[model samples]
Target chain A: MFSLQGYGPSILEGTYLTLEISFVSLFVAMLLGICGALAKLSGSPVLRAIAKLYTTVIRGIPDLVMMLLVFFGGQVIVNKVGPLFGYNEYIDINPFVAGASTIGFIFGAYMTETFRGAILAVGRGQLEAGYAYGMTGLQVFSRILLPQMVRHAIPGFGNNWLVLIKTTALVSIIGLDDMVRKAAMAAGATRMPFTFYVAVAINYLLITTVSIYLLKYLETRYSVGVRRE
Target chain B: MDFAIIASNIDIYLEGLKNTLILVSISLIFGLVMAIPLAVLRTSGNLYVQAPIRAFVYFFRGTPLLVQMFLVYYGFGQFEAMRESVLWPLFREAYFCALFTFALNTCAYTTEIIRGSIVATPHGEIEAARAAGMSTFLMLRRIVLPSAFRRALPAYSNEIIFMLHGSSLASVITIIDITGAARIVNSRYYSPWEAFLTAAVFYMAITFTIVFFVRKLEKLWQRHLMPLEQLDTKIEAPSI
Candidate 1:
């Protein structure tokens, strides 16, 4: 009664795709997040203002709405610009690219906040000490600031990651064929949505449960030699 | 680029706005009402009492709300018994399914938030309440719940905005919330920007409003934690 009906391989492939989208988007989000954190923390007011606006607008809008806007609006913009470039045939944006990038872009705002707070949590004296030892600006950042910030950023980063994983489910709406979409298709064919969705839910639970343990291990690893009250 | 499409569809957007607001508000109310008891039970010492609630919270919080909504809307229909049950009528409607999923989702998060705050309630406060000769129920009612609610406010506010945003999923299931309206306009005129940008604006306005009110409530509730000079200064006469 609880069989996968020969869709086990398909669901496993979908799960792999889900994780691929997650890691790719995580990489994008982290890149944007670091740049954004630096921008916000920079001495320049214009950089700070741009960072502020990016975080505010992105966080205020829903992820699904942002995905729709970027996916469809982006297609229109690309095709319109294609004509001017003398390539006027229709061009469709890949759902995988659109979905990953939109999730990354939306979560980048969140990652900015997380990274900014993490950076601030590092002591001013530590950076001063690094400079006092004659370290280059890049040296101080990589050797001093980045290491300590990981400990502070882990909790918020983990939270963002879990939410991002869930947000990937929305990509199925735009036809990305993630596990949620795969489950939907399987359910449609089998006429047993309860079995299929429950399977999908269990898959998500496994991923999240594994993530929680890994995050805890990282937190402890990074907290070595630091005193905890 | 087509302002005319958006201008012509303003009423549809407003109707969608109404549905979105209704969905969010109702679910929030139900979630909070349900969460309070579950949270209390979650904090209990008995393993039996806490275990079931823990599993409920874990399942709801672990999975995506979209999946939960689908599990309710589509999954339930798979069972012949559920189809024959009296609850089938309510479960059949997309609005009900969305509300059921959202309320359970928010309730899980809310329970966790309230649990954290409850656990963090100052030991001194609990000792003081005990020294006052209050019963456990009385102490909880008078001391623990109030302070926990205050402490939970900031996190709870985030959950509220999340629920508001999550309500957009209702459109996926055929409910004409703001996103649903945008989807319609986009499909009708094939103009994504006008349709979605308007939806984004509506959502941003609501988000800001929620933030604004939560800030005000925090100020009012956390007034005692404020400095003496800041207290009651609003009643003072304006400087000449």
Candidate 2:
């Protein structure tokens, strides 16, 4: 009989933490992504420049480096900044918060590109048609643009989501008690590195398989009423 | 902010950069070589050939590289049979282990990039090649591969950059790559900003260089295709 023994519960708990961090990061990434896309599409040159720099820089660096820089380097910045605000005390960042925000920030750059492409994929004529009907800008966006954009965005969005979920594993490096770290501990203790890591790999595969199904469902849902070749 | 620390540790960083470049270059070259055949097998008409390739691709793509690296480097060491094997000597070195892992991981991604473009190879061209009495080998060599490779350049460039970034993981296993150097400096001086930001700048420099060359390569290859203006607007999402 195979058993994770007492470590099974901890691994399960780690799985929950991983999921929590991923979903929260996804939400935050979407927010930053949408704003970034808007900024890139906006008329102001400064906004466009900022968005461009953000995406380029994020894309250029590794996520592990970014996570380290943010968690440790960011803590230093905060502690330094805090003293100026009269707090005068060292502050420690929660690994969950750091992990979520860094993951969110990195993926936000990817999402910015995804959303921007999706926005562009929506036909220009649709916006002009809304304007012809005397629809306000906001009205045009909400009524005409969003629904169509969602359909185009789904494929790219799905890809990002898969990558983002896998990226959550990097949080383990920053000392987050995620599944990978838990597996490492169990592997070290039991001297069965292959067994534990294989389990973690299977867990990832299960997440990916479920995600592929859900994404296909989303694609179909958004593709409703559109005639296909 | 602390230029003095950076100035003093510049040699250490440079030494680490040498290792990073070595790791990335060796792995990337080997990875690309391995990926092409895997890609051909992946897009093959024969189900038996494609199935195993698909499984390999899925396994590598699904699992995190950190775990893969760990499994190869640390996990293998736990077994007495592994230690007794002839391959044990190679796996014993962290550098070789990291290189092997990185190469294998990038191979999976590159295979998909190449396979997608190979599958998208225009039907008419193949038909024309057939009509001209070109053999399967000639058709693949002269027509399909060139165009598929050209199309895969942009995506492949992203893969190259990704591998460059991924080489940083070598640091985790105690190899003194750029990130490893940063970690050492940070530990010594307690200056995270100076340490990591310097590594970030070095990575950015390499990224920009790759982007520049890829752009040139695209221009050369895509001369008869879409105009530069149109190509500029085709924003691609960041891929894994």
Candidate 3:
């Protein structure tokens, strides 16, 4: 019962890749979400329209299709354009970039919604008071809106992150050796789909459980300044 | 670059859309029916009953729907007993599998959302109903679901939009929905940009339409509260 068969290595390796993809994608999405939310909230119409388009398109398309289109379709674009620029080498999108970019781009839309709601939740009174005391919009945002927005946004952000982690399972279809794909491979090799898939489920549960705890900790820390009564 | 193939296959795409609609509508209706009972169970305060419902919600909501779909389809297909069993005919159909998963998944989310709304119904109203010697079932039927429908309406609308999008995933497992049609076109023609972009535009249009209806429904349902809310909002607006 305790035999370490063909399953262990692939599962472990896939776990690392999944974690790497998730972390990098989440970081990129956060930056993108913040910038997108700020752009939408910006006073300029052009910036707002652009932000709106980004979020709307990402939200509308199914995550699976987007991943396939970006991974397969992006490769085509890259290959076509590559040979035109003096030197042509066969450059393919590594599973990491494909996985990370797709997940990040999609979740960035969700995170934009989270951040926008949180920013709006930050009372406008404070910003007005800051303005009365000669604070600029940039100063008001950084010194006032940003902190409260982060706090209010934590739970929603946590939810989005959880969904994002699960969506990464789709990446396995396009040859990213994530936990799901690795388990599928192991299952193929070992002819035990149930056992391998169960292992994949556990891997996801582990990652999700740990992330929830971290999000909880961050939530508590962020609430410190505002919860003083 | 060849428009003729896609142009000629417009009928296939329409057929696919019809199948997608059938799957979505049936699952959503069934999900709604099941959710009401499950919501009642969840809020009943009997640990023996509520515990299982809680567990079911957590298990379903905590996991991705695609995993559940695959588990039902491929995972269960692994069992010869399942394949040959009385349920085999039903399970063999991708439509049934997708609908089953969609219904069950949406039920979990909807049950929680509905239960929250029911619980949030004014205690005064419940007391008034009970004070009048109303039966439990009667009170729930006449008072709870009706009132809770108002509160849950917003969340249910969100779920509706989500399920519409979720229907797209059914294509992955050979359901041949709108998304399935798009994939078929993409592979044969290698025009990923047009194929996928067209699908995205269609989905966006549908989502926008659903959202618009949800907003209208919200306003209609909340008509009585609007005046008070508007007054409160007006006061808060200038202050904010």
Candidate 4:
């Protein structure tokens, strides 16, 4: 049958992979973002320099290049290092790992800036107050700074996460069989590029709409005490 | 293979840099010109005029640019009727398709940015212009645009840098920009380290130029808009 029935399941499958990739990568990126922000604000010059280099290089390189490098370069590294590191001889980075890592690396740069700004936005005196309360640095960060930073970070973090989700579409070029690639294949098979592409666009719109609503709820829940103005 | 050996082929990298600059600058200039009216209409009244532009801004902003590029290039290419149309020749040219997509994508983002800036212009200034018997057109020209542009300078600088980075995506549709050139070199030499590294340096250089001008412009605006004494006395703290 020359219809969209078959297309739905394929797209739905791709959507699952896409979500899996984005969620895992975003989790990793969040870790890097916090670490990078702390490093930038740390007293250690070497750590600051290292963090700066990480963000700069990641931002400087195009995502497409980074994805390719990670995918191809990772394969080469794993082949050599896996045996030496006591892993399976045939251990290789699948497309999902490669895509997530590259996208995570790229977005982590942006998230670092977003997080650092959020951290700074939380009043400097707030941290001092935590210290005044006889809390250690670790305690101060967890108890006082982290909560406020989360509220401040939500808006910027949400925007960056949206971009991160869309950026996952680029992984299709590297054999991840994301929505775009599946659409391309289906279009090629059915000779209906416009319809197939529109299907993919609708899929993107659905995911994005759901994400925005979810983020809005989080924003509302987090901003409980503060006046929005 | 020593990475330093790639220096012998600096000429190719320079050529790619030249092309990348061409694509970025051309699209950005045209995008800027397109942004003004779009921004004006976006924040203006009249749902009939504003609704379509709003939808456009949402669509382009909501989706990934890579997919949009594919729609313009491969999606349209698949249409036989479109091929026979007057736009066919233009669309057939990969460079033209790349520029068109870049221009449209940047237009959406710049419109949103410029609209935000325009709306953020102090309401008191507009009221003062009205009280002083200024015409709508005259007030906008004399006060609104200049101030809005100033207000928008910081965000606009980031937009421009992004455009420069975005120009790399043109290579996906077969326009031989810097990234494409780098990929070619990598495949030929089997040394991605050198090729991608060179490309990264080129992007960093472009980014440095963007930041340099942005700093200079910010300083100029800082001087013109607010006196140094007041600026120092009250730093406008960033709110996330």
Per-candidate DockQ values are 0.90, 0.67, 0.45, 0.52
Per-candidate total of colliding backbone pairs: 0, 0, 0, 0
Clashing pairs in 3: none
DockQ of 4: 0.52
**How much is the lDDT of residue B177 in candidate 4?**
77
Worst 10 residues of 4 chain B by lDDT: B1-10
lDDT of 3 at A68: 73
The CAPRI category of model 2 is medium
The candidate, 2 or 4, that scores higher on lDDT is 2
Task: Give native contacts recovered, as a fraction, per prediction.
Answer: 0.81, 0.65, 0.35, 0.40
Candidate 4 per-residue lDDT over residues A41-64, each given as its tens digit: 999999999999998777666787
Model 2 off-target regions past 4 Å? A129-136, B226-240
Identify the leading candidate in terms of lDDT.
1
Candidate 3 achieves a global lDDT of 0.83
DockQ of 2: 0.67
lDDT of each: 0.95, 0.91, 0.83, 0.84
Q: Rank the candidates by lDDT, best first.
A: 1, 2, 4, 3
Predicted candidate 3 versus true structure: per-residue lDDT over B42-101, tens digit per residue: 898699999989988877776667767776766666677887899999988878889999
TM-score of 2: 0.94
Top TM-score hit: 1
Ranking by DockQ: 1, 2, 4, 3
